[model samples]
Target: MKKFYYTLLALFFMLPACTKTDIVPFTPETDNQLLEYKIVNVQGSPIYGAINQQDSSITVYLPFYLQLITLEPEMKVSDGATVTPVSGTMIEDLLDLFHKGREIKYNVKGKDGKVKTYTLHVQVQQPDLILQEVSTDADNPNTYSLNMNLDFDSFSFGLDGAGFAADLDMIRVMLVDEQNKEYGPLNISTFNTTDLTRLDFTVIRYKEQSDPILAMLPAEGLYRIRVYSYAKVATTKNPIRINLLNKK
Candidate 1:
């Protein structure tokens, strides 16, 4: 009877050992987030996307000419995370029908099967007023001659927008001093469309009719030229700085 009791006790201990439970290890989720986004240039270089962490938004600037076309920008994500809208190193048709701004949605799935959605805002760089020539008035020291070209015409802004076909009134030249002080937002009253790629026009600067800020312009100094579009309410690209003619 004692041997039988010992055997029963031994069987009970063995049964507990056989029923032991295995503890599964715990895993913490790592932040596998998207980092940079970029537009591809002509040279096949990746133009990184700009991330605004404050607003949880991304912005990518394309070439002025390509702004109106569709775009597929590339993205860089965190380790082990995959992003949607993937393409052949470039996202295609990402910015179709570019107005002022376009929004792109991205879905990022991490290795842990968690997903995050991101909004990417895309914009085109401002068109510039390309300087063609600068001439000086032989008769007056304060008077100057400027022959400039508008980088883009009416079609470039938009064909269906309200600003279309209003090329002459759409643009104004903003002059600033070396210190970035505002001088004048001069109007380009007339344009010659002899050149399709650009608009050619001449500007005559007279001290008497010029803005009061022009009076502060030094005889010879550095100044910046900004071409603003009234319709778009934005400045064009390539704000150029030039040295004033040393009229002694």
Candidate 2:
């Protein structure tokens, strides 16, 4: 009788570890619960192209162009469950910010009154450059155009600031048009005298698909303007600039 009891106990313990699906959990009573979640040790941005799935908490690198995302499995939710305010983030910072060597905790609770909140943390560091697209002519005060030029800062060219400027590899630019279509597949590798980051998106303004500057739209809409590799941060002072010229 004693041997049988021991075997049954071991099976009970193993069953949960084997059968339970590993995923973020969800609840019905609180939107604030999910909002409190956070990440650590990631160097990217708030509009991250997608998400990183690991055994631990998701990593969110600030100012990079990445965002945190989570999907929970439902056992009790019927007819499909939904989470409101699905994603949240912190003040955009430009650096490798570790979560103070601690995990961030959220207060997630389900309709059944079960709490699923968790904690996260990350390591931080300073980035090399700033990624931005401020108007070259501030007086214009217009959103970027499909046909535009990057207006970089004064330090932008030559062997003085950094060696990489002379041997730069790529300049990637992308934009989605008003018709829910991506107008570019544009990529630039040439630097005029100033190494002023330039991406020719003039063809895209007419809603045409161009390569090296890839874009895809849902319909017809100018929903996004993206520039990368100019720096690590989503918003920066130099490295790149967007001069929305007069509808070229």
Candidate 3:
């Protein structure tokens, strides 16, 4: 009985040491913080609603020649959290108007007292080229012909695009043969300057003996006319191509 009583006393003394210590639980954020960002107003035909959000950053591609660089954005953030540079806020113009993009920071404070900063990138994109019309000197309505043996004249076309022509650093015109040979930064003239939405340009073939435009191409083969757009800041997208054939 004495030994049993001593064993009970030892067990009681060890109970406190066996107790588990209290610890704080770990938490991972899974809330949908940003819902949407929409462009509200703009001038003359600038593209909008191009907001792409990844994680905590948002990107907006604006037209290159957009004169009024200001914009009002509508944003939707998580519930119980407030954001700065609030929705419908008219952001000021870009710092380096013609050469650089703008950045806006949005601060969000959640209900848990945590603050996060999201970056908004406003960038410009290179204009896209489109062939609105093409014409050749071929008399036959059914077939087109190119007589490189002649003075290399009588070809013209109209060009337009999804962006402004003023945004382009330069437009390169090339003729690609089936064998992948490219020829001519063909001289072209524009009809107007201010409104570049639609440009009517006429292709002028050089008559120089040493020029590639004077070289005699295949009499009967497939050829392509490519127009490339180079922007001042943005990456140039794919060039526009127009296919033609000479059935000589």
Candidate 4:
């Protein structure tokens, strides 16, 4: 009876070892897409590209002054995927490609050996205002003058580009003294309507009700004028040096 009980316990323990469990097979990843793209470390601001998965293309709008050849793109791809000309590579031939109206191309491959190509289209944004020239008024010692090219249609619509009447208030004029002391939200004298392309205007000395001396233009100091709209700005290319002891 003791031997029979020991044999039954051994058989119970061995039964579990003999049973089998299902094994899961490995599956290769098929995801191969460029998930995100951006141009970073540019002159002013970082630019993000709009990605269109359906068309497998990306579009980026850059400031007109930004050189395309200097672009180093950062990209993110799907897991288990690799992209050619890897991220953070400067696109040397970008300007030449743009001049020929050709798009920059990138290739991505997945672990399953499948590949997809994506094209990048770059465009330059049009300026709302262009500064042409700036100078000091010889006739009026305290007055500063400048010329600019205005996109009347763009200025009329405002910065958001969604309005009927012209938002003339969007344009501003300012004066900066040698010490970097800034003055004015000065008033523009008037516009020369004869040639809209060559819009001419003048800015007289700024006035303040509280401080008369501060209101008057300094008799002797280096100064410059700044003209700007929402989209662009123009300043004296060279500083205007002044040394008029008799003038107020």
Candidate 5:
């Protein structure tokens, strides 16, 4: 009975040594990343930014009409991460600093106090008016033609009327032959502005126009249609090829 009592005392003393008093405290997460970014509340449309993880940079393509001063970007970051120049903050003053050809820096700090910086690049997407469709006029098959699907709203006109003035903008229709010879730079001066919502060209009088080449039916060949603007040059990515049947 005395030996069993001594064994119990030894076991009780050993329990204190096994108890862990120096427990490792929980460590805060160290994840700091700018996951998603986008510009919102613009005049036309919201522009989404592309995040490059390799270089830790974000790039956004802003339409020419939208100014940087009008941007209020929305951002998403890693959990428990805080961003400076917080989301939805107007960047008018920041724009002044940006015009100096400097990248805007966005800093994100994690719960662990580790910070990651990301640079933002803003690029202005140029205005392009594509030739959507072209067809022969039914009323005057040989004399009149119609141009369709020209987006006038895409072009931004400045306060001083620097861009896309109806008076200055014109459409050129050229006839190309197998020999690559060009004929008739038929210019359409009249534009259909009755619909102020979306301005467009209505009809092209091939025979009635003053251009002598357009006075008669264009020789059977490939006709290329292009819109011209003094403020900005127009480009046609896909040139249209149509066969105009001579009036019976």
Candidate 6:
């Protein structure tokens, strides 16, 4: 019995020592907190939105971006961070677009991370614009001037998104006849993609060199404007603007 008691006491003392073992210090990994990223346009199109700034810097188009992260405590970017607005852009215009997109994220660095960015959908809001047929020559209703109604001090994107350094080759304009036949590739003379609710698009009258006189077409016929924007592959939405005067 005495021998057993001594052994038990020795084991008890050992247990206490085992419980107080020293631990090694931990070190966090040092690397750019990035998993994967993507850039897209407002039409929910995938693209590598970028711009070559003549000056070492330029604002580029990023209709939207997403990040796939493995950790949560690790942040990527913050919300409402001052992003380099797309080059040739206005803060007010960008803000309006961001607001319309409803999902905006800041490109952050280090612990100031935003989150496991799901999908911050930015959109190219139709600039608040309206197209009107104002005739300088009252004698000829066919001769009219296309006027633009714009309300902005600063904005981004251009008419038809051209000259803004975007992929314009993918955009086009079309004109459909009464039989729905097409005739175009016409230059978008006056139109805008700025963030607006309404905009004056273009003025068209019978031009011998350009458009055939309305009287030449079927006196009793119909027509439509087809806008095939580059966004979808198998499916495309047609925003048809018609001749309100001719339509019954």
Per-candidate clash tally:
8, 51, 0, 0, 0, 19
TM-score winner between 1 and 4, please give it: 4
Against the reference, the lDDT scores of all candidates come to 0.49, 0.34, 0.55, 0.58, 0.53, 0.32
What's the TM for model 4? 0.39
Better of 5 and 6 by lDDT: 5
Tens digits of lDDT, candidate 5, 1-248: 99999999999999978957787999954478898898887656678899987788999876544434456899999998999979987655433443346557899998889889999887666354433333334232223332222221111110111234234323234444444445555444344433212323222323334234433434233433444332133433323333333322
CA error at residue 32 for candidate 4, angstroms? 0.2
RMSD of candidate 4 to the truth, in angstroms, is: 18.0
Compared to the true structure, candidate 2 yields what TM-score? 0.25
Worst 10 residues of 1 by lDDT: 152-161
Q: How many backbone clashes does candidate 5 have?
A: 0
Report the C-alpha lDDT of model 6 over 1-248, residue by residue, as the tens digit.
99999999999888867656689898854232323233322335543322221221212333212211111111222323323222222233333343233433333233444322122333332222222222223333232222112211111111221112123333344445646666554454334444322223343443333333322333232334444433211111222323323312
lDDT per residue, candidate 1, 1-248, as tens digits?
A: 99999999999888867767799998854455677776654456766777864555777766544333345466778788898876334444432323234456787788889877778766556543333222233232123322122222121111011221234544545555556665565544344433323433233445445334334445444444544443133232223333234323
Q: State which candidate has the highest TM-score.
A: 4
Estimate, for each residue in 1-248, the C-alpha lDDT of model 4 and write its tens digit: 99999999999999989969789998844488898899996866679999888898989887654434567899999998999879998876553554346557889898788899999887667355444333435333342221112211111100112211123444555567766666665554345323334333333222222222223556555566565443345565444544423343
Q: Is candidate 2 or candidate 3 better by TM-score?
A: 3
Model 5: lDDT to the true structure: 0.53
lDDT of 1: 0.49
Candidate 3: where are CA atoms >4 Å away? Answer: 1-32, 42-55, 63-68, 95-102, 128-248
Q: Which candidate is the best by lDDT?
A: 4
Model 2 agreement with the true structure over 1-248: per-residue lDDT tens digits: 99999999999888868766689777544322333233333543222221222222434333423322221211122122223223343423222222113334434445555554334433222245333343334344234233323322111111112212222332334453434344443443353536543333332333333322323332123334443332322321222223334323
Candidate 4 Cα errors over 4 Å, as ranges: 1-30, 43-45, 127-248
lDDT winner between candidates 1 and 4? 4
- My TM-score estimates for the predictions, one after another, are 0.37, 0.25, 0.37, 0.39, 0.38, 0.23
Rank ordering of all candidates by lDDT, starting from the highest: 4, 3, 5, 1, 2, 6
Residue 224, candidate 3: Cα error in Å is 34
